[model samples]
Target: MSVDGGHRRITNRLFYWMAGGCGFATGVVGAAFHLAVDRLLQWPHWLADRLGTGPLTIAAGAGVAALAITLAYLLTRYIAPETAGSGVPEVEGAMEGVREVRWRRVLPVKFVGGVLSLSAGLVGGREGPTIHIGASIGAALAEWLRLDKLDFHALLAAGAAAGLASAFNAPLAAVLFVIEETRRQFRYTFRSYVAVIVASAASAFGMELVGGTAPQFRIDTDALPLVMLPLFMVLGAALGVLGLAFNKTLLMALDWRAKAFARVPILYAVIVGAAIGALAFVMPMSVSGGERLIAEMPVADLPLKMLALIAVVRFVGTMASYPVGVPAGIFSPMLTLATTVGLIFGLLVEMALERSSFPVPPLTGAAFAVAAMGGLFSSTIRAPLVGVVLAVELTGAFELILPLMVTCVTAHVVAQVLGGRPIYEVLFERSERLAGRMPSVRSAVTSSPVGIDDPPRSETR
Candidate 1:
């Protein structure tokens, strides 16, 4: 018994070492993916600056976008279909034993395809591909290390945390994301939990070393007064409605594409890519993930009509782009949409109070922008804590934590009360049906009402 205990101790230590190594690899890959996408995205902007936004520049942009997106689509459809879309659902499916992570194919395909598609100014985020990359690294390591089934599963979860940590440089939020988002699939042994923490820390350390430890975006704002709590709650409720609509529309679009582009899907890619690429040349801020837009957009200075127009365009852009079967994520796009909507609300409130005795702060729009980031995320993802942590971490707005909490909880409650399913679960179901592992009892792209506390109804898992 003593010998057995000693062997177990050694095995545990080795498991931790493997987890750390896996996390470090994920961090390294994620950093490379981020840097590559950023650098590649600069080429178009540089060209457009020199050539001006004329018909030629627009045509060039369309051609470049078309080529990039077409290549990305081919890679996913022919080489690795699992590399398509936000890989979060695929990772979730893997955790539930419903899918396999083909790391060998996924690693290269997701990296190249993601960089190409994202650089082409597609409306998506990096977090999804990064998370998927992290999980693939974990799977690769697990196989190479000959880990047991349980250890392999734990390592996959750890890699997931590492991925998110690397993406936003938010280690705490990454940990919460694994805990809240994958609670149903993750095995919760004490050692497994510790492994997740270690992986997240290691990945964050690596990412910070390469990309600095600053927040992803900064917002200059003062704390909200107690009198504004009710207003934030109202914003949360409104975001909940938006979240439901976004989910429904996104799914419906995917469903439409599955039937409409069944035979010649590449044609669909060309059309979307060309149109968005041209739009990038015409209205550069309207395409791509909304990270730069969130960081640099002058929300306070923009008119209400402009903000409303921007919001609509982004909403439609995200809906259209995700269905193209490319490597993309909705997180950044969703945050951008939420920020625009929030700023719009703030502007309205400011206008209302401008005539009253109550004076509005100049940065009120920014504060609401911060809160709405969390609110919309909570409503759609159904992970209030993850959304709150992500908002605070990404924006460095600690003073607005109370408002963030109020909005996130209100949004989550509203989404739940309205029976809107979590977006990832909805995506996972769609993936399962597409793979022919699950029966299509309902419409391919429509969302069904799911209870807040319900477990995923995947029988194959």
Candidate 2:
């Protein structure tokens, strides 16, 4: 066989092995990271309970947590800025060949920073960091094996899916997330698809062995009342608007911070920490990641006015916490926002039909809130399938698949009609423009011209 044919065969084999191996490794890392964060988060709550007071009254506890979170953000910004924020945009830029991956720096920094930031009560999710870390691992391994760039890209993609799979224990959702959201950059083919599936499955298997196979949420299976469907649709539309507003608020916060504190970066984080500390005293729910709130929201008998207040606080708090270049994500905040709205809507419906025999259980609102969590993500990100699958896996609400699908599809359509772009895409463009200002080695090579006698080209001669 010719050299080219031999090289092709070797590349194909390497691609498969790298993709599979990276996926498995990502699962292991992601699972371990998630478990560690969960354990660490328990400490503050335990301490608060021991003191016979809420988080606010425990002054020492709240101060320590805020300090730790602020330090983590500083470390991320100073050591590895790329690991800051959701990290989804970084992977997208890498796939587009617009950004280079420095695995040596990114992997460790993101892992440590993510653990610290999340544990310190930052309003973010582990999945974002896990995704970026997993991709870094894949790319590093591929480089170590001396694989070609194309094969490396495949492995990176597979690892990203596997990371998400392990983080949420949702393999199918992970695969669909990469396929749908990364469609613009990913070269979709039979081989790539198989690689993604294998990675997701392996990650899921690993998570099951370690964390068990239970879904994230324990939602009731009762069908949503027909009367509530219209309410859900309206919630979907509102969420779409909310999503846009969320994005705008985040950008504005960042802009304001940049302009106000152009010289002293640390002060930015200090101010946020101070604000969070104060907020913790008044409204603890508005400060930390929405995980605890999400879990407790179903059982809380909050009035509509209270729920609305919490929703507004969460929205503003998320915007404030995120603008300081912290290594965090929006998933938790988005879920909290949706749940708040859904709960309020359900309360209104209950008051309107108080005389009816068929009363809407609180769990129904919880379920709709869960479904809206996915719908808002789908609409904002324009990845309906991923959003739907993520909702099912996170909440274990597969029985409500029909309603979930309806909510997500409708939200996606509305978001598109409203002229909104996917959140990650917007961030990626921002990063690209920032990175473009720096000089690159590729410019040198492309700038040089080929001599007439260079080599016999493939052109007709």
Candidate 3:
């Protein structure tokens, strides 16, 4: 690249490393910020228990949650509308120069709005919004350094990797996710790849420094018999269809919410929050940022009927809470949904296998729950390696790696055969259309050496 000095400038490894440091800070901040939200989540439960689960208590709880969510919605609508659901797509669009990034607006809005939205017991996760916040910081820093858009892209990717690593305490998987899932937008240079690694490791360290070293989930899963390998394939096929249906429902939910928000705006947030607030009273296990619930599910001893009900409601809640332009993510929700489906499937299979002479692992349900994390993620994100590593790293369920591979790969192929694109690609297209632009998702994805300039041909507005 030519510079003002009439000299060629290569990718700056210094700035890349500096971006890694920035990502460390972002991870520290993101972890602490979400930890605050987790603390705040206790207030409603405390108030309810103190006042008793009477009608007045329920009313107060619901009112507070609704009010909190309504305020968050207001910020999103009025301040920075780009702070909405799974900002990953927006970042991808920005990298392609298809969408602009106003880091000044996005950073504060996403952080504050995400905190408020999650605190309201919404069915969302921290990783997505944190990823946005990190990218915003990266972009802002690039501008501060007087760097060009090229450097901005690398820093943005570095920060994003840090965000995921910090949130899940899985550095390697975070890097893989960017390399695989966002490879369509990220221009991978040796410097950029190194930056990603540094950022991911730094972020994980930062998070663990603040939070404890506990895994995201508490499970001691035993290694499964290779004899049951075919079972995992069947499980994968099930999750593939389920993930396809999930994407379809999420898209429809986004459409429904867009119309609702157009008419009533904040009322969409109010109604959803109020309803979920009420539901939380009876099935307290069904609500929250989602990951904790997944971990608790196996140990909770909830009956099959109640478990099914919670899973379905949480699935609907995720569909409802995220797509309404809320400052949230579908990551934890997808894991929660996948875990439930896997648990239920395993339980049913265990019952059937109990009568048969076929040998099955004693901890079948737990194994399935652990492995299904990769399966659903593979289908939705279409990045099997990332999904597998992430699931194992987050849950510390490494005993079933073989099965996880089987499940994730099968699910990925099935989803592809059924003609499902990655969820983020679809979201990117939808967001662009919403903003009065048309871009080719196919060509951009297939293009070599992705770059921001020269967007691929598309149907124009």
On lDDT, the candidate that comes out on top is 1
lDDT of each model, Cα atoms only?
Answer: 0.85, 0.72, 0.80
Better of 1 and 2 by lDDT: 1
lDDT of 1 by residue, 1-461 (tens): 11332222227777788888878888888888888888888867787898887899889889989999999999999999998999889898887777899999999998899999998999998887888999999999877766666677788999989988888888899888888788667776777887888898889777766873322577777887789889999999999999999899999999999899999989999999999889987787789898877866644488899899999999999999999988888999999999998899999889989999997876899989999999999999999998899999988899999999999999998998887888998999878877787823432221112212643456437
Model 1: lDDT equals 0.85
- Measured on C-alpha atoms, candidate 2 has an lDDT of 0.72
The local lDDT score (0 to 100) that residue 428 gets in candidate 2 is: 71
Which RMSD values do the candidates have, in order? 4.8, 8.0, 3.8
> Model 3, residue 288: what's the lDDT?
73
TM-score of every prediction relative to native: 0.92, 0.86, 0.93
Native-to-model Cα distance after best TM-score fit, residue 144 in candidate 1, in Å? 1.0
> For residues 1-461, what per-residue lDDT tens digits would candidate 2 score against the true structure?
11332232234555666677787777777777877777776655676666656545556555766686677777787788898888778887787677778888888788877877776666666777888887888778767766555566677788788877876777898888887777766766676777878888887776666663321555554577666677667767877777676766777787788789889977877767666654554567887677767767767878777898999888887777777676777777877777787677667767777768766554677777777778888777778788888888777777677777878877877776676668887777666666675422222111111211122244336
Query: Looking at candidate 2, what is the lDDT of residue 263?
Result: 93
Task: Give the Cα error of residue 327 in candidate 2, in Å.
Answer: 1.8
